[model samples]
Structures are given as C-alpha cells and as structure tokens.
Target: MTHETTRIHPAALMYAEEEKAGKLSRREFLARTTALGVTAATAYGLIGAAQPAQAGGHAQQGGTIRMQMEVRALKDPRTFDWPQIAYFAHGWLEYLIEYNNDGSFAPMLLSSWDVNDDATVYTLNVRPGVTWNDGTPFTAADVARNIEGWCDRNVEGNSMAGRFAVLIDDATGTAIEGGIEIVDDLTVRLNLPASDISLIAGMSDYPAAVTPANFDPENMLGNPVGTGPYLPEGLEVGVRATLVRNEGHDWWGYAEGKGAFLDRIEYIDYGTDPSAWVAAAAADEVDMFYETTGEFIEIIEGIGWERTEIASGASIVIRPNQLAEVDGMTPYADKRVRQAIAMAIDNNVVLELGYNDRGEVARNQHVGPMHPAWADVPRIEYNPARALELLTEAGMADFEMDIVSIDDDWRKNTTDAVAAQLRDAGFNVKRTIIPGSTFWNDWTKYPFSSTDWNHRPLDTQILGLAYRSGEAWNESGFANAEFDALLAQANAIADADARREVMAELQQIMTDEGVTIQPYWRSLYRHAKPGFVGWDMHIAYLPQMYKVGLAA
Candidate 1:
C-alpha cells in the first residue's frame, strides 16, 4: 500500500471514533471519511466489515413525510436553475452519485466508478437490473445519452453544458464524436479532453440526473419514468407535488435491504415566507420543511423539532449583466463601474442585517472557506466614497441601474441592503422585487439581479459551470481568457494544496474584474419532527428521500 492510503486523515479518524461510539451512522462515517480522501474499503475496515443498514434495524416503514417547500417547474434536468427542482425530481429521478452534506460521496444509480490516475478517463459501472417505471431497462446507453445531453451546448440554459464542457467541441457547440463510449451493458466510459477531478461530483449535481435515451426534455412531468422507489402521483406546479411508493416494484436497492422507507412523500408550497412555514410547523401541518434561515431557525427549533445544520459554501450573488445596456450605455461593461459597485457595499452588513449573522462575511470571491481550494486573500476594503470616485472616473456617476430580486425573506433583505448602500454612494438605483413564481422566468437576463448559488465540492466546479466564457450559466456574462486557462490548470492538478495555488490567482482575477458581489457563505439549516429519521440538511439543499423514514 502507498503511504497516502496508510495515513488516516485527522477528521476521518474522529469520524470513525464517532461511528464506534454510536454517535454517527455507518453511512455518515463512510461519507465523512471518504470525503477526506480515505478509501471506502479502508473506511469500512476501520468500522468493521459487518455493519447494519443505515436505516437501523428498528427503523419503521410505510409512513408519509410532508414538507413545506416550493414545488417548481421541472423540464430538462440539464437546465434546472434551482436545487428545489432537483430535490423534488429526486423522488422519482435518481442521480449517478450522492454528494452528501458532510463532503462524502455515496454511490447511487452507479454501483461503482473508477477514475484513471490522471483523472482524464472515468469508468462508470451502472447498477444492473434497474428498470424504469415504464419497464424499460436502464443500461450504459442511457447513461451515455445523459452525458451527451450535458455536453450539448445547443440546449439553451443547460447549466450542465458548462460542467461537461470537456466532452464537447467549444466551437461547434456539440459533443465530441467519441468522448463517450458504451463499453458494455453496464459500463460507460468518459474520455475527457483534460484531467478533471470534478467529474463524479458534477454527476451528483441537481441538473445531472440520468434520463432515458429517448427522454423528452419538453415533457418531464408528463413522463416521470425513473428507477427511483417513489412515483410522481400528483403535480400542481406552485401548489403541491406528491409521490407514492411504487408498490410491488422490485427496486434495485431493496435487494440490499436499504432505503425506500417512506410510503408517501409530499412537498407542499408555502411560498417564500418563512413565517408561513413556521406557522405550519406550529400547527403540525407539516412533518419537515426544506430549509430554515434567520429568525425562522429558532422558531422551528422551539417547536420541538430537531435542527440539522451544515457549514456550506452556499451564498447569494448580486451581479451585473455585463452584456445588457441602460440609457444607451452598457454601464457594467466598464470595469470601473463593476468595481465601484463591488466596493460600495459592505458584506459584513449584508451578513448581519440581511441574514441576522447566520453566516460568515464573504470577500466578494465565489470561493468560500468550506471549499477545498479556498484561499485567504486580501479583502477588498469597503469604501463608498472611493466607489463614487471610481463611478465618476468611469463617466457613470449618475447612471440609473436596476436591481432585480425575488421577494423572498433573506434574498430581498440582502438586495435591499445592497440598494441602500449603492444609493448612499450617490449611484442611481431602482429596486424591482418580483414574485417567486416569476423571478426565475428570465433570471439571467436582468441588468442587475441577485441569484442564490448552491455549494459545490470543488471551487473549480462552480467556476467552470457559471463563470467560464460561453457557459450557459454565465449569468454575469464574465468571459476572461486568463481566468478560464488558470481554471483548467487548477482542475488538472489532483493535489488540493497545489490546486489551491492556482485558485489564489483565480480569486484575484474574479475580484479585480468585479465579477459579482458575493456577500456571505451560508450556514444551511433544516428542521424535522423529533421522530424523523434519515433526512439531514444537505449543503446543497438536496433531499435523499428514499433513505428518509419516520421513527416509530
């Protein structure tokens, strides 16, 4: 064995001890350990070969679990803009891997996977005998089709296109002819243009759910056929969505005697108001809620429900559309204008006033402390007077800019705080608060707006998916050749310490160019009843409902 495999990570050692003490589940132990670079087999050996199922022997089955959350539209999985869409779709649609809140990854649709030493080639072993709800066999071809969909830049707003860009020709906007190969009925191979450690992690993203070869993007709700244990029983868009157990269906996981504990799953719409959810929890109208923030965290906890918290890199970005124009001038197109806006507001105030000190102040860079590549760079000092000087220097001192935001509690508060700061700096600003139902309709087209970005395992993952030039999710229209090249270099280096050196350069470029004002890194929270089992707060706000059960 290599010296690396023999050495136990400090965090992994603690997790193994916790597993032995009965304070952590075997699944959680493996998740935390493997996330720290520990091999799965080694981790299992540490905790003993014979172990009980994660659900526990005393786990009760066949019960309903209701949650107060938004039920958004679902179309092509590649274009999902929010985690809720993926969370809801997961009831029926399954991802190739499960990226846990603790930074560990668990195998899902794929029984196992192997990556070459250079990380350029990935071999995926699909779980055999898995059947879609429509009785179609799920094989390697289906996985290849989903990968093809991710690499196709032709699909507008396909965020996965950027994440899987290595598999496609950037000039032609099409997947490279032989990038994906079906090695066998259960094996699929990925030949990437370059080394990328984020491939498996990308597959775990909400938008990367595997679909059938002939799956129709225009009609997902109509054809919600998947190998998951639950079936979509009802869907009412903004109202509510329900899933019932696929009775008598021989689920692939059942043979291992794991998961599929709940008979029914429901996601009821409670709008963007946290108080509405608090009221529901008080009256016992819901079993759990999607996420709790600000004042709602304590309120939900005081109701006798257990709170699960995760330190996440999730944050909100208040960015400008560098491509859009206002009053015959593209103000954000000027570097000074973007920089001035970035310097005007204080992220500390956003965290305190908007989030009620629920998170850590950000340094205007997308990378957060939780990310492996996060660098402690010099902070961009907040100086409104200096911001005004830059605005005047750019000949846009009085340019009227619009700040659009959703009417959600924390997001709107955060936007309001930014608008107030910009106004104090003598900039002309207009605030447009849209309903949650309409906010995402044309979210990326706004001249200036706030977008909630979820957490990724690697900082380079989000950089490729959202900031790279020509990426579908490049909401700020940020295209920098230097930034993209440096990103590729970072992805190629497998060592975290070495990759972090390149990330420092990336963070500097992102800040120097005034890409986006990322205020704070969120501390995510979720609440469930005392007897609730299996469900935990995910850093990305995902729900693995199949393993979620109620304790009797």
Candidate 2:
C-alpha cells in the first residue's frame, strides 16, 4: 500500500502530517496537496483513502448534470459582472488552475508552475498538446495574452485588473513592458514588480479564464474558442443554457482520466427565489444547485439528495463608500463614522437573521480562519453606546444613510437586518433593494451597499481586489498608503508562518480603519443526487461541471 509520496511538495507533505495529527480535515489535506501539483489520486493514496469513483477511468461518461443557476450574458472573460456569468462561461472557458472545494488548487490549462523563493518570479509550464475546440494549438502566447488582458485597467469593466496589479506599474495602468515573458512554446515566465504569493491562486479565479491570443469579444458566443470540454449549444439569458460535449475534439484532461466526464451539462435559471429551486429539486427538474442557502438546506436534504459543505471565506461586506458624497458632505469619509456603523450591529445577530446561523461570526477584517495566512486578530465588540459617541464625534449623528443591496433573499435579509440594527442605535437609516440585473451596474458606485465577495485562497488576493487604492473593484473606496505597504510586505513572504505575522498587522489595520463590516465567513453547500461522481461544492461557487457525471 505504498503511495507515491516522493514527488509531493514539502509543504503538502507537512499538511499530510498535520492531517495525521488530527489538525487538518481530509478535504483540507487534499486541497493543499493538489494545490502544490500533487494529483488527487496520489493524495488520497497517501492517506489510504479510496479515490473518487470517477478517478482512473472509472467515471461514467455519458449522463447530464443539470444545475439551478442564472445564465447571465457572456462577454469578455475579464469583464464578467457576476460569478454566475463566470460559472456559465466556464463550461467553455478554462482557467490555468482550478481552486478546489477544500481551498486547494489543481492545474488546468497550465501543467505546473514554479515560484521563486521570494515569490517575485513565476515560471508557468503550459500544458502541451492541448488545443482549442476549433483545433487551434494552445500555447504560452495564449496564456500571455490572457495575463496581459487581466493587467490592463483600460479595458472597461475588467474586474481582474486589481488582482493583476502586482505585475503592472503604478504609473501605467497596463502591464509592465517585460512583465510577461514567453520562454518557449510551452513555458511562460512572470516577472512581478513585487512579491505576491497569491498570483498563482489568483489565476484559478473565475475571471482568469484563458482565451486564444486573437480572441474577439464580439464573436464570443458565435465562435467561443477555449481549451475546455463543453461547447455552447443554447444560451437564453435568464432562462437556461445548454452545453454539449465537444465531440469534435478530445479534451486535454481525458487522457489523465480527470474532468470532461459528463456528456452534457445544463444550467437552468430558477430566478433568485430559493423556493423555486426547492420545488424544482423536489420535482427532479434540477440535479443540483449552484449554491444552497441555509434557509433551504433542510428542504433540499428532505428530498434525500446528498450535500457537500466547505468552510469558505465567501462573505458579504456592508460598508459605506468613503469616496461618495451626500448632500455635499462625505460622512463615511471619516473613519469614526465607518467604525460606528460596524460597532452598531452585532455580527452574530446578522448571521442568525440573514443566514440562519449557518456560518461563523466574522470580525471586520476580511481574512478568515480557512486561509493559510490567517492570523487571530482582535474582535470588534458590539457597542451601540460607543457607536453613538463615535457618530456624534464625526458629526453624523443625524445624517441619514442609505443601504443598497441586491433583491436576492439572503442578501436583502442581511442588509435589512443591518439597517434595523442601525436604526435601533438611533441613526437614520434607509434601505434600497434592486434587481440583480441593475444592481451590479452601479454596485461599486453606491454610497453605501453590501457586496458578496467570493473566496480567495489567500487573504492578500481579496485585499488587493477590494481595498487597494484605485483598483477597479475597490468598492469601499478604501485607500491607505501604510496598509498597502504592509500588504506588499506580506504578499512577498511565501512561508505561511512568516506571512501570518504580517497578516496580523494587516488585519488590525483593516479593523482599525473600519473598511467593511464582514459579518460572517460562509459555509458553502451544494446538493446532488445519488450516484453522481466528482461534483463537489467549491468554496468560491465555481461550477466545475467538466469533472461531474453520473455513475455508470
């Protein structure tokens, strides 16, 4: 029963030992190992656990796995407005890496990668013999093009610009001239200006889907060129999307007996109502859910379908826009006002009212316990009396504030709970609920709003996206030179223990500044019928349909 443990990374081996010591869950152990380039089968072998039924050519390859999710419009991969759009487009578009359910990563378009000791340079080894559905050879140039597009802030609605900022010059919004180097047909090198340990993890993000060097946004739907296994057959926005397997070409992973197991994949829009999905699941109309909220978990379970859960950093941030103004005054610009808003509401109450208490109460800091670089920082106590004092000191005691949120059940409930708490604290509060279609249009521009941020493997990744000055997705308009500097210092340190020391300071700064009231770290769930293999709940809500199929 000897496993192939010799080639496992030292860090992954350490994680295995920790698992043996009862310090890590099996899922967590596999996640760390797969992220470090060890295959899932090998990691399972090391623990003497049976591999998934689909692994090693045991997969049933011809059934469909229909999921209940919104089918949003498809456009440039970098400008995907919502995660559902990314999840839908992911059927045809693939990333360089796959972030697993347990916060680990798996190689996708790129075979493997190596990062320097200081995390300044990343040598990406592109998977050879891979080709687009149209038979175009996939190469390092395609990878370079995708990276360049992500680093370009000039592209309107390019959400990836913030995460790719590490490779760009501050003066120029575009990537540095020599930041991406094509070493050969199969190798690509990244020369980062600063050390960023999250760069590789960032690639697995939904928006980082790689496209051909000459990809055209206008013809995206007509001729979607990707290295994935599925091709768009039908896409009726807000209704349904049908993706059929690329029978014309063999997927790159087929030889490895990994993903591309399902013959057809379907995404049906059940709207924002969980009740609609509950009924649909009961009727056997949908095989699984894009995500199962706490309110419907019991109903879905009563249907006898199995569920997978993962503790993730996915959470909502209710905060005021520091850069926006109201009545010729920027009330939230004062840190005291933001701090007062955070202090007025109890996160535990919000969790109970909004999520049915399905998650852990989160401090104002964005970092979560699941992240490798997480540090235990101070917690902000719920103190309405102190909150009122801070509000009076900031000259906002009577200033009315508006809270905006999407019209979905969980989000609206969460925002309503916060607004009620704020009103109870003697502050004037207003609530606005808008449709999902229109809400994301001006999401970042809202004076005060709640935004659901997806999970990133490292805390630094999410910080760069949401808090970094002038980044495209900096919804809170939070900017501090000192905090940014500390983040840079933390990103450069690759060792988790070393990075954690810096993370402690970063977490303190985030809480002290009151950037956002991050109420809870969500526990993501998904339910699938019996006999389905390889379909697991992803922490980030990424739809990894290529790996899913029913048993033979």
Candidate 3:
C-alpha cells in the first residue's frame, strides 16, 4: 500500500493563510474562535480513508481453532483476571457495544445511544433478543451490575475501577461514587463529571465487554456468563481456556447475518516465553499465537507460518521514581539528571536485540502520529559523553540507582543494556531482576526503582495514572499543578483544534521536564497456520477468538 501525506483540512488551510497575513496559525485562530479544546479537524484529516477489501471472495464458516496464550485464569470478565484470560472469555461473552473495523463507534448489544448537549449524559439503547449461555435474557441490569462492580472498592474489578473513575461525575477522582444508572430493562445512562468526547469513542471501541449480572465475582471460579456468540467449554488457570459457540447469541449488530464462524477456540497461555509458543504454532500444535515479539517473526515465518503485523499500540519508557528521595533528594528531580539518563541509552541496540530490526525508533512525544493532539517534541540523541557531562553537572555522578525489570530473558537483556549505558555515562548503575509476580506488586507500591510500563489507553489516561496525584500507578511521584490544570481543561474542551493545542503543550511539558525516558515502541507479530483466518489483531494486546475460523 502506498503511503499518503496527511491532508490538512480546508478550514485549517484558511487559518494558516490568515496567520501568514499577521494572525496566528489556523489552529490557534480556531481555538480562539470556539473557546473549545483543539478541534478534531486535524485528527480527522490524519485518519486515512477506509480501503476497500478485495472482492469476489466470500467468508466460509465452521472451524475449531486451538491457540496459545502466555497465561490464563478463571473466565471472569469483571474480576482482576489476567488480560489473556479475559480476551479468551470475551469470545464467549457478549458486550453491550462493539467497535467497528474502521475504529468507529458502533452498537452491539445496544441498538443506539443518545448524548445530551453538554455531553454529560449518555443514554444507551440496548438490543433485544440476546440470551446468555444459560438461556437467560440479557438486560440493562447486567450493564449496571458490571459498572457497579467496577466502581466497587471492595471488589477491585481489574483496572476498570481506575478507568471508570475517570469517566463518571460522582466517581471522578474517587472510588466510592456510583455514576451508572439503570433506566428500565433495555436502557442505561451514565452521567459524567465533565464533557469528554473521547470517553464515548473509547467505550464503543475499547472496554466494551459486558458480563452477566448474575455471575458472582468471588464464587464464579473457572466459569463465566455472557451473551456473546461463544461460551466457555473448559478453563484451567495458568494453562488453557477453551470456548465453544453459544448458538443462542443473536444480538451482535456488527455480525449482522454472520454468527461466529468457529465452533471452538482454545487459548493456551505460554507465559513470557513466546519462543515456545512459536514452536507450537510451527508444529501445528496451536492454530495461532498472539503478541509474538519481533524476534520470533522470522523464525515463525521460516517454518511455513503466515503472520500479520499490527502497529505496536504502546511505547516502552524507563520511569524513575521521584518520590523515593535519598537523603532528602530525588535524583530524577534534577532535569539535568533525567536528560543525562535519556541521552545515555542506545535505543537502536535495544531494538536490535528485542525487535530484530522490525520495530521503528520513537522520536515523537506521543505514542504515535495517529493521535490527533500529538506534537513534535525535541529529540535527545544517544550520546554517552553528553550524558556523563550532564550527570557530573547535576552532582549525581556517584549516585547509585536500581533499574528493575521482570525475571525474563527479554527484560533482563533490556535492563542489562540500560545498565551498561548508564555505567558508561559515569553513573553507578545496579540492575535488579524481580520475579514477575512480585515486580508488578512491588512496583505499584512505589519502590525506589525504575521499570517498564505496558500499553496505556491514551495520552491523557497515562498522564492521569502515572503523573496525577494519589493515583495507584503514580510510582514516579512527579506532580505539576500546571500540568494537571491543563489536562483538566483539555478534557472539557469540545473543539478538537483547541484540545490539540493543549495536548501539544502537555506533551512539551512532559518532554522538557524529562518526566520519563521513552526509548522505543514495541510491536506485535502474530503467526497463524494458513488454514486459520478472520482473527482480528487488537492493539490493546487482546486477541478476538470469535472472529477466527478455519479456511476449509
């Protein structure tokens, strides 16, 4: 496919022309005019037109596909179950909504939805005729129950608690408020604290899964109930999750006349070692393997496996905890120290080892240029000499610090390279490999260490979780009142153009302050047997099982 230059909107061009004649840029002009956040014109322009699929071919049904995942658990969508396990269960469970292929918001369980003028109230229209695996009617009560579970402090239902807190009015910035209301049997309404357009889009695209109201969180071990086209057949925690077609599901709007084409989907979790999973796919032991690291792409393809390359939705960054002050001093508090660390590491070397030449180096401030509000930030090239100079100037040359990573070969290699680079830059570096289970647990407790974070939903989400005050994931303890204010303003702004300007400003602040040292973005490669087809590669690191089928 040929790459196209992003088309700036006509209004944007007019604004640019006006700016050239002694006014600010069109973006600035529009931001002033609407008094809203950055306008969506630029983002809308950046999004490429949907490409037409090849014609003359029809989809075939019927298949039982076996897949390998790194891990699994009891099929509970509402609980703090593993993501891989949730992805496997999502196939069997129906969601209240579903995302379209083009990333547009669409109705699945809900036939339609209405938003008030202020964008604070959202009324969802639930579809009728959907039944759970046990032949129970799916209703809005189920949606309300799921939302209540997420907002419940005692339940701790996965990351949704924090995420939902950001969306609800009473629930915003707090875990106690219940913002979801059940409006009769087929209708549900959500009242937000602020007007956020992105929330609606995110609800339709990501986080659309809705579990049954009757499914008990504490007692529903190894079993889940949903109105999805598939139902769980068997489940073994940390081992495998299997699903079979529900046959009773008829509510999905996106599927229309097409039901789940597969009869069964078996997700076999293989842990951090994707190499073993790749071997399984090559040996035909598994029909497909997901989130395959770039290093295994060649090996899988070399063995007659076909694969799909999806954009790595997330970037890998080294975060230094600023709250863990040593002798009344935060090492990362000094801008010079952070810059020095950023300049010391060689991203190309890490990419070579981790991605095997398939991934691209990230120089932009945001995760990708596709994000509407993204801006070009100053780049810090790899220069160990400069790094040492900065470290010395900051009087941190003798400072010893721990770079933490999970006890996995890939993470070990990454931290090792970072240690060597920092050492070469004249800083005392100690590499620590914490067990994977304990790493996540301790890292969140704000241990005095640096570690890697996975894919975050959006720039704002990451900012709120990592930089905002009192956030669970705020290990860095980096706080800026100005940054927080700007984020709040951006969240309420309705105009896309105005929002972009604020977002750009936010990115600039993070980069200039050296909040985190983002080096390389990670990519995913999926290897599947030629017989398998229709599986959607999700950027959220979750794979869709109901979409897959065997090509007879």
How many residue pairs clash (N, CA or C atoms closer than 3 angstroms) in each of the candidate models, in the order given?
0, 0, 20
**lDDT scores in order:** 0.82, 0.82, 0.59
Candidate 1 at 165: error in angstroms?
1.0
Write model 3 residue lDDT over 1-552, tens digit each, in one string. 001224333444444455457444332343322111112333223232233331111346766777777454443454432356566657755555443333333345666666554556767667777667667887888767766655543443344554555453443333334457788998788777777544544443233467665565454435556666766776776677777776665535334654467777777766666677776776678878765665566777888878776554465556676666667777777888877877887778766664465666765243444344555655666788998898899988888877777765455666677677788777898877776545654565442444544444344655664676544456666788898788777766644456778887788777667667666666656777776666656555543555566664
Judge candidate 1 against the unseen true structure and give its global Cα lDDT, from 0 to 1: 0.82
lDDT string, candidate 2, 1-552, tens digits? 012235555666677777788776676577556655567677777677776554314467687879899778888989875778877778778898877764456677888776655667888888889999888899998888889889989888787887777887767788998899999998899998887767767788888888886788888778888888888898898899888888888788888667677778889998888899999988989998888886788888987989988888889999899999889988889999999998899999999998989889999899988777789997677899999999999888988898999988888899999999999999999898898877877889999999998888776888888898877788898999998889888878766767889999999989899899899988888888788877778778776777777776
So what's the TM-score on candidate 1? 0.91
Each prediction's TM-score versus the true structure: 0.91, 0.92, 0.79
RMSD of 3: 7.0
Point out where model 1 deviates above 4 Å.
Answer: 1-58
C-alpha-based local distance difference test score of model 2: 0.82
lDDT of 3 at 512: 69
